[model samples]
Target: MSREIVLGVDGGTTAVKAVAFDLAGEIITSHHESVPVQYGRHGEAEQDMNLIWEAVADCIREVADALEPDDTVVSIGLTGQGDGAWLIDEDGEPVRPAATWLDGRAGQRVNRWMRDGRAERVLEVTGTTVFGGLFPVLMEELLEADHERASRATTQFNCKDWIRFKLTGERLTDYTEASRSYLDVRDVSGFSTELAAELGQTDLIGLLPQVRAADAPGGVLSSGAAERVGLPAGTPVGMGMIDVAVTGMGLGTVDDGQGWLILGTTGFVGTLLPEVSRRRSQNSMVLATGRGRQVLEFMAPMTGTPNLDWIRNTLGLAEVPWSEIEQRARASRPGANGVVYLPYASPGGERAPFIDTAASASWMGMSLTTTPEDVLRSVYEGVAFSLADCVRTLDMAGDLVVSGGGFRSDLVCEILADVTGQTVVRQDAPEAGARGAAVLALVSARRFPDLEAASQALACPVERFEPDADRGLIYRATKAVYLQAREAIRPVWPVMRGLRYQDSAGDQS
Candidate 1:
């Protein structure tokens, strides 16, 4: 018998990563390529559909070729960054550039929704407050901004859905992707007409894609898809979940009350639940993962490791590697010696654990004695603190499966464990999303009955971190001060924004 593998494609915001995994969740081989996005105007982020396809196809073909001569790719699965608005004609051609989840042009609509209580109502239905980066609002924003392009569009797809359509000729999505902002997921099967009408964008009702679970068969990889991606025709494909959803499962985050955290370009802290949460927070996203379980996602749009990269560049420490930075941070003690940093410096502001569009980064208690290393260490603590706040809000006092680049740092893992007062677990697989996607495909292909069995059989944590009581006590006090600092700085954020806004107006005038 030939070795069998599944092709798991992670079509992410900045790049496409195609990984080959066996039923055991081992990474056989992988290929990756970055897909660029264009920022045309304020809040406008677009990617060429052709460019995305090229990157994904190239990665798939390359990874498949890397397999052993006798090996066969039995299935294909996909996952991508969530909430990008991808529009295409009936023929699967792009009507316009695909707007990414990071695009913020719909701020005007987001503001209106927040002001008029539409967002809170959205929280009641989908378990997530509507925002500019979501698909539904982007649909309306697209139509109002570019009627010509919007009129030509025949349907809408999220980033993963678009990639899956290109792979299997099926225009569909899964609950993990669609539940965030598009469809009503109360039943966890199809679109919610009631929620659509509530949003006043029922016109988009027809544009929504049919959603299925990750284990459901959407379609087979067609001959055309095979040729384009250098794979065998008729390869069975599964409707993959959102990146976070699949990543969570791959990390073995299935037990009730187990929280999963992803700290990539953004911060996501979520826990698996037995049922959907009726009382949702203004900043939490309740996701039905199509597995009869609900996940409460309290994501922070601006708190991430990117701030560290930016700081490294700003401080002219480009030559300093992350390993060295980690060493320096460890040499210092917890709390960074009276200096505190808030990791919300992004121009777009923050989105979760409380939606504050005017929020930005703040550095308080910095003295002349503060060194570059001190600031760097403080930044590490700052990002952890931000995620700590989210974990607190989610009330996740159980085990946490952690993933992302920041996980490479033992210090970060320790800090997170300490701050959250929970054990932090890390698996051997770095590509959690790809592992989940592969397992999901295996289930669809009947290699595994469901995600739980797959996770239990193939996944195991390599390292575990427990909170230090001494450090936890320190963080308890420090977190209170940090919370106070965040509140105190809120009023200052809009004032800072007004200066720039008034300057821009004056310039135009």
Candidate 2:
């Protein structure tokens, strides 16, 4: 008797990972292929679509090879990073390099809309604020800046949608991805054509793909893809949601009031709710959970482990191990000796909890006696403080189910639990996005009745971190200072932006 396995593919900004899991959700085998992003001088981030597809193919082939002779891959689920514009022509070829979610070429456009009240109008209709890298905002910029690329584009697919098209030859997107900017937050599956017209993007209506639920019946594997991936032709393909939604599912956060956090390339934290609430602040995204009409009030603040990465690299500690860095960081007492770091290091600047493209990282209260360890530990605390801000904005009150590469350190996990005042639950596993996609595949294959059932059956065991009373009190006081420092530094962000570009202009001239 052959063992039944499901395959989950997560096309992330850093890599394309293919993970195989049994019916119980235990990982059987997995493979990853790194994908590179091309970063531009003016907040432009892109990737070659064909290269990403090739990486996905390589990962799938490697995972297929790892399967035992008696093991059979019954279904495949797909998920990836959401937002930005991946333009494709009628023949399903890339019109240009994909504009990724990290791209901020449209920052000025977003700022224009915000100043003219168009940004708030977007919030009113879509239940979310506009960011530079959002699909619609990018589309508006592309149309005005690059006529050739805009005119050639017939469809706009997110990262996973592009991969799905290559696998099944299907052009479709799920509600999770669509809800980023297009679908009405009140109506998960409905398109807002009026909002499209208001943005002067009515042309986008024709470019949008057919929206479906994450577990809905998607296309089968095509013979060409089967040959390339070494999978059986006609294998079931599950229409999986975005990495955010699927990661929540993989963590078994299906019930209302469940909160989850991802501390990867960016910091993401959200609370699951039964339905959309207009009363909530519009700063965060209101997304379809891809499990019935459930909603996820989500925020992706531009802060994460990258703060640590930046400091480590800048201070010539790249060769040192992360564990050693953590040890040194721990030597510094709580509050990093009065140093508070802001973790907005991304060139695209900060979004979520607030939108500010000119935002940059800073370390305040640094004295002559401050040590490098203080700087390092303060970076971790900055990220924790940012996540706490998002949690407060969304009213996410309970245990936070946490995942992502950043949580590997005990110090970060403990700090996050104390700072947020929530018990942090972690499953020490990578490829959670892929695991979530596998859960969706199980439901799509009809082996499970619904998302909730599939998720419960395949859930991973967790390790919990309880908040320390003393540390929580200290964090509470520090967080107030953190918020105050953030606001105080806001007035200088634009001046910093001008100084940076001035240096660039001097070099160019």
Candidate 3:
């Protein structure tokens, strides 16, 4: 018996997962470990870089330990949270706690660029609009706050690439991760020095790592990493793609026009396009795909499950179990009893359909008749509607692959199906990112010729939520109300910001 298995490790926002799979993408076993994230002054989100590595090592070890006598782990692949600057020195050691993608310390820099038309100029070359907490502006923050530490930095990589560096002892990143940063997304190649110049950070161009293609060798696992993960030292590791990019692939949504939504720490809505359409917008990223004829157009709103998590923790709903919370949502009518929630509570604001950094979440048409359940249910609908808005922008037309924590709730899936008026396919694999990483590892191991074949053979969906015609009609009206409210609140956002600022100053006095 050929005990050949490929392993994939995913470093997520709040947890790290390692999942093992056979050649046809069937799950053999999986292990998970929770990790810590620290938030400090000025919207800062940081995590200990070493803890992530240890988590990956621990999870990998757990999975490796479960292997039968003949079981042999062939190749390993990695995926992680996108964005947030992870800095390391020439020696490949972290200089400080890695800045997470959620960190907003660089909002001011983004605002400055947006105002001076510098953002527009850079977008011309990169074909990407600026987002708050992105790497280019975040790099400026590191250099400005502490030049000494910044000077020692020789290379910068995304969260996933940092882990790959430890495993393979070679620093490199794939195009998917590169496109998330300051790289030239138009051609899907290397860094755009011109974009760096517009941001007034020319030096950052050199710190970029060499670009590596997917399924290509990302150096062999070293003795140190092998010892920690209980794997052979010479095992090949492939340069993995972004978590969002792999989620669709893991679901086997490879055919042209196939699309999916990932409701993780963030809400990502994407579709596979037939051509490389380089339409530039703050809400979308145009990416070149492995198949020369296809491209990926995606938009990720900064708020997703995190927004809902806030409602539970901040609104005293934590005492009630989430299962009960789901029941409340399910009890609520389609319109949440006429109460509506805008999920733009994120400081980064809304980035889909339109880019509004100052956008604020609001409850429109709430009344004393509204119950806590109504408010909570509206939040679920609010997030789904936001993602639906983005999907409309991409024009994704097909059965939707919905994967993430939010989708675990049957109510959430029902609402997505109704709101989008499409069948929502939910897979049994909870760790879509890790499973996708396994798909990459299998490709690197030559288990199947390439990704498409591996995906078709291995990817499977266990549940399907088809749209209810009656409910779809109801949600069509519900979505209209949501959009109208969104427009109505635009002018009020500036006033809201001013009042909040004034309230802060008054409290200080």
Please give each candidate's TM-score: 0.94, 0.97, 0.93
> Model 2 over residues 1-509: C-alpha lDDT tens digits?
78899999999888789999988887888999888989987788999999999999999999999999899888999999888899999999999899899988888888999999878877776667788888888888888888788779988899999999999999999888888666887766587888888887787888988988888878899999999999999999989988878898788887888879998888898888888863367778888766666788889986577787888899899999999989989989888888998888887889978889999999999999999999988988998888888888888877888998888778888988898878988986667899899888889899899888998887877889999989988888888898899999999998997676564547644
Model 3 ranges off by over 4 Å: 278-282, 290-294, 314-321, 494-509
lDDT computed for candidate 2: 0.86
Clashes of 1: 1
- Candidates sorted by TM-score, best first: 2, 1, 3
Residue 385 lDDT, candidate 1, scale 0-100: 87
Q: Summing lDDT over every window of 10 consecutive residues in candidate 2, give the lowest-scoring window.
A: 500-509
Deviation in angstroms for 24 in model 1? 2.3
Off by over 4 Å in 1: 39-41, 278-282, 293-297, 498-509
Residues 393-453, candidate 3: write the lDDT tens digits. Answer: 7777777888988889888889888988888889876777877777777777777788888
Please provide, for model 1 over 87-184, each residue's C-alpha lDDT reduced to its tens digit, 9 standing for 90 to 100: 89878899998887777678668878888888877777777777667777778888888899887887888888888888888888888777866555
Which residue pairs collide, candidate 1?
A: 43-105
List ranges where model 2 is wrong by over 4 Å.
290-292, 503-509
Going through the candidates in the order shown, the clash numbers are 1, 0, 1
